[model samples]
Target chain A: MTTIDSPPPPTLRADSLQAIGVEDMGVRYDLRFTKKTTIRRSVGQILGRGSQEPFWALRHVSLRVVHGESLAVIGPNGAGKSTLLQVLAGIIRPSEGAVDVRGHVSGLLTLGAGFDRELSGRDNILLGGAFLGLEDEVTRRLLPSIIEYAELGDFIDAPIKTYSSGMRARLGFAIATSVDPDILLLDEVLATGDANFRAKSKARVIEIVRAAKAVVLVTHDMSWVTEYSNRAVLIEKGRLIMEGDPAEVVALHRQHTDEARAASAAAATAAGLDPGIAGQGRR
Target chain B: MSVTSEVPAAFRNAADDPGAARLIREGLADIVSRRRLVRYLVQADMRKRGADTILGNFWWVLDPLLQMLVYVIFVTIVVSRKTPDYPLFIFAAILPWKWFTTSVVDATSAVASQDRLIKQIQFPKLVLPVATTTAGVVGFAFGLIPLAGLMLFYADRISPFLLLVPLIAVVQYVFTLAFSILLAAGNVFFRDLGNVARHVLRLWWFLSPGLYSLAVLDEVHVVQANPILKVIANANPFAILFEAYRKVIYGAPTSPPGLPDWTSLAVLLLVSVGFLALSTVVFKRLEPSFAKVL
Candidate 1:
């Protein structure tokens, strides 16, 4: 329908996506124990305090993500979903396991990840751009587009601390998308902004992912995963329980969670009815 | 867990942990490329303190000059029985010491203060403290001009040893950088270090030869026996730098008392290099968890 004289719409070129590999990734956090100081305890422990404790946050996870693949990591809170994202982002090393990443990996752990409250919204865009590893000149050249996309007119020059959460989200989302990344990691960022802006942000992600090559989206929203992701990985207690079709994975996760909850409920009911079962509780 | 299945079949597997090596390579490159950010941050910091003031950056010069005036007046009235021009002598020593003390203290807080930036950015963690030190050095250099004028006002002859200021400043800066990194890393784990740092600075100020001459202490062998005081003073980079300042301003005949010429400078240089290296290693090691801890 377009005229010959008019220029054609831009096409997303290939060679943008690349493969990422994770092998037997494990992470452990070591915690030092501090003895509670009581007068009696301190008198007794002129000797010494107790030893520290060690806990595993992630234990022996393995997965392979190929070129142009979308993987959704879904779990309840504190299920090591964000830890896995951070490991992939190269923010932290796995205590054990190997990760091989090809090409640029960009992430949104949360919106306004690098917003300087003292700096203006305009300056934060530059700071965020630099923090994300874009060349200064490239950021300068893209400045106009970033400002426009933020849709945060007039407020751009004001200090960012003055901004509302939605405004901050707009600025963060704009700067993150300004650079085309090979591997995109999103963690609960799309839920921010107003309904109108959220629609725009989702459209932008769809537009970006068409050429994203490899993406890992960590979200609690099963519907969003089933709609957007090609495959899904269900996580529970820091282990990968299932990985396959998004619909099947989401269904499995729900069923599994429900069954565990029901089982716990049934056990509680039985314990309440039986005095013998309740008798062992104090011990 | 076999490597052959994960890596490309065409490429041969090697003994090296390529994942860690790759992280380092990319991380270093990314940090190196963000040099502009360091410049921006430094500029931002300079503006942060002085921008709205009427005097702008002249405050850097004025801030220390005013302190020197107070010290000069107090010492001339109460402490010194000297024929020497006390104001010029104190000004010479005080300027550099102030720079060293303030720079290290500021740089120590630099990394911790930028808790948000540390969480968000992937840039080199060293850049924060380095930028802090750089800002202090720049301000300190500006403060020196006023001190130079005061020296001339007293009709004291400036020595060619003045040329060594740049060289000495670098050594002092390197030492301060090392201390800042260690302190900053410590401060991240325990906020109490910040409060302790203030007390440490106070003790250092009194113990240092900044306010008084080290030459006077020779009369008291008690000072010689107290190696803790002696070591803290003589081993301090500021002590060496301030002694050199005294040498230039007062024309103190011999080199600063306790330190050996080659040995002291060499010790300082080695410590500076070692600290820089240690700070880099420690900062990088601690960096992976900074985001979470913050």
Candidate 2:
């Protein structure tokens, strides 16, 4: 029923939709101990010989998030979910392949990760806002809204160290979400807050997912994955093992976890060790 | 539901780490574009420092003033030196020396100290050292308050040449920045650089013409015997900077102040500007691995 003269919406363009793209990217860490080497010796080391081992944190993983879509990344601890988000946020350079993010990305890589505890929450908000590429005046104009979002009350003017851990996470979420970023990357940012804040933050994330050009979130919350995300990615041992509807990806993730647990239990029996004791420790 | 695997033409590819030329060009470009941000960070850093003390920013003025007094006392009574207007002479060097030392110490730890921020945020990490170095400018300006008062004590020493203080300082700032970005990047790999930097800076200050003028160095038999030693002494950036500072601030005890060796300073500026470019490239080359290491 639209007239031929009516122009196409800007959202229909591929440029707007291709908010983030990664192609077969990998990250490798030099697994050597941090040895004290002087400038000359290090230059020599860089020139050629090295006995250090390398570990790949992410390998052969291609991912993309277009506008108007939110992808949930569900993976076991140490499965490189955080690393993938960092890569998309352009914090970590990939060792192989390419990554392209189309917009100003606001990544909550670690909740309240950069706050200087000695400074006031207000000061940290300004600092965080600057780090997010917001001008000082812009951050100042947005201050009331951010403070309101955190609901820290007078505590907003207090040093961050005095605030409880939950308060810190709340402030982090508030500052991170202050800007309506084109791409939003969240890494278990809602895991720490109390039930009320978690509910509120979850609702906020849902709203952002609808508004932001693209969003990538890493979470262990199974219900959240199935209920909220347009798609889910399952990462295992530094690889994207599955990607599909949230329900199916979550199913595969659970199945893999169960199998891995069973295998560990079987190995514990072979070693004549108590599975209860061993599993209780690390896992 | 559809996701384009192709990287849009507008999207920058991270796989291609830039060459040295581009790294230097882009590094400077980033600094220019983010100059306002650098100012904000510098102010934040100064505010953080001010929050830690009773006197706070006042110390910036007082610390140098007190140090000048101590040096005056030592030189006149303890050492028995007859350097004229000793307070003005030493203060001239002390003021710039404090700026240099603090800039070095701060920049050395700038990257490693912000491990959390570097890990979490994606802004230019170079801003840390640049901001830290720039913060010294504020402290230096505050130090000048005492410099003004000290100049009043030796009223005869003040001259029109005093205005050249900023011009000489601009060269010193460039030299300090070259050292800063290099040290900041190196410190990430070698955390001990933080401690090593302080000791090296102390030795550097003494080696410079801070405590003694170049004319005094020329009087020493060892310096006079070898032309190469004289050449090396003159080659020091501080040798040029301190001499330039002395010309405008202290002047000769016998005659009025004269213009500094402009040729030397111009040469130093050019060298520093080139070194800064090289350092920026080194910094950008190491930047990608900073998040991983930190």
Candidate 3:
């Protein structure tokens, strides 16, 4: 089978160095007991009678990413890293401030997130590509490469539900990276697949970053952050803690983690709990 | 490669935040550009629904045929005996009613059902309900084959008015599309609305002239006494549509107060256009919060 040619270069303005800009962006979600309760509260609120607590997933944060830049976001669990990516992907609307993204944006926030389980993997590639705003002809042209990169072989014709988790990840990664997006948002997508496949996907991710106008990566892998990204930002409790060189940021993140672990261990000892148990509880 | 001096129209300008009009325009443009996505989703939905069945697309036709058979058997054996061409009559009404009811019901959950897509992807959410309605329309078109087979026995009644079937279908399609969009958008916020929709559709079924002819209802004095009920009965698009189907398909006489007048078509046209505009506004307003809610 014939392989697809390289994707055409992105059409961007010569003066446009910024691929993404965030001005004090914030996201707040209302915590509802149930759908009915939410509805009742909404009606009550409209009537000026009810008040509900809202969870602020991310607070005011400002950042700018220029073309050909790979910005790695490092943070602990629930640090609003994914929330920031989601906002940039336009999946989540900010409650305060604004996010401005130029060009065609694609994100691998969740693998096979939109796939229909009953449909064949071949069909899903088409559907997934369409979701990314690729035309049918373009997706069809890229189909052979997607299948080859996924290494599904004959299984490509089978329904996606039959594939293993790793296979699903491979397919998702292949389809998401098929196009040279102007801005790419990745949320730990490269953390899947076997060792060999991981190496292959990591190389592919590097290539995509080179081709993309800008890239935002959220990952816990410190090595990947230090090696692949030029710059990094650390977020804690929904606030931007620091932004600097990837290596420096990684070191700072490690320092913060160690301090947090030590502080928790001391607190656990004071509470008469096992220090080892406290370390596990910190997760 | 050197970047182009002319900025691509697809790019969002960071200088000015997009307002409601720009958002709506962008949403529509996104949907139009991603029409293939809509087609694929509809095909995928149709395939998934029937993937387990050996009959495949045949099931689409069989479902309504089975429904017509049950209604025919019940009406002929249990309800009444004097009604002529009962299967054909019930079927003519049932086809459009099925389209309306199924589309609305399916669309009521369209957005809510695709929680994954809503949460993970950032495309025009309008495509979800629109695609569901289109799938219903496709199924409705398939159901027509069996309707045509039944009409073969009543071939003598066929006339140029049979051409009006497509026109009638377009009217119903618009009505259903508008209604589905509203329900889908509303359900995203108030999921209880979907639960209420099931019962409302059941009540709507009886209110329409699906089982019995409008002529029979006109004979009942109680329906005529109350102005409210009279207006409600007359304003029913299903009743008007079914009556139109019978008039065109069965060559039945246009009985005064029984046959649908121009006012009925006018009402349908107005409702279709009005509801479409209303639903578009509502859907756009509710769209921004869909991901959070989902």
- Candidate 1 local lDDT, B1-294, one digit each (tens): 111111121111112244444544543553466677777777767866664589988988888889888987777777665636667667777777777777777876777777765644445666677777778888878977897777676653565656666766777777877787777766665556667888888888777777777766665587777856665667776677677666655555333222225557667878888777666666666766565555
Instruction: Provide the TM-score for each candidate, comma-separated.
Output: 0.82, 0.90, 0.88
Number of clashing residue pairs in every model?
Answer: 1, 0, 0
lDDT of 2 by residue, A100-219 (tens): 787667776677888888789888887787777776678898899999999899998898989998898889888877777778898887776999998898778777766777779899
Stretches of candidate 1 off by over 4 Å are: A1-18, A33-50, A259-283, B1-31, B51-58, B78-83, B116-121, B155-163, B224-232, B253-267
Superior candidate under TM-score, 1 versus 3: 3
What is candidate 2's CA lDDT for residue A3? 10
Candidate whose DockQ is highest? 3
A104: Cα error in model 3, Å: 2.5
Model 3 interface CAPRI class: acceptable
- CAPRI class assigned to model 2: acceptable
* Candidate 2 per-residue lDDT over residues B53-83, each given as its tens digit: 9998999999998887887898788879798
lDDT (C-alpha, whole model) for all candidates = 0.70, 0.83, 0.80
For candidate 3, lDDT tens digit of each residue in A1-283? Answer: 1111222234542446777888888888885533443466678776767566788889879988877778999999999999899888887778888777877787878777888889999999998877766767788989999999999999999999999999999998888878777788999988788999998988887877778878899999998887778789999989999998888899989999999989877777755766666656654
lDDT of 1 by residue, A157-249 (tens): 988888898888888888888867777788887899889999999888877676776789899888778777877898877888788878889
DockQ of each: 0.20, 0.33, 0.35
Considering summed lDDT, which 10 consecutive residues are worst modelled in model 2 chain B?
B1-10
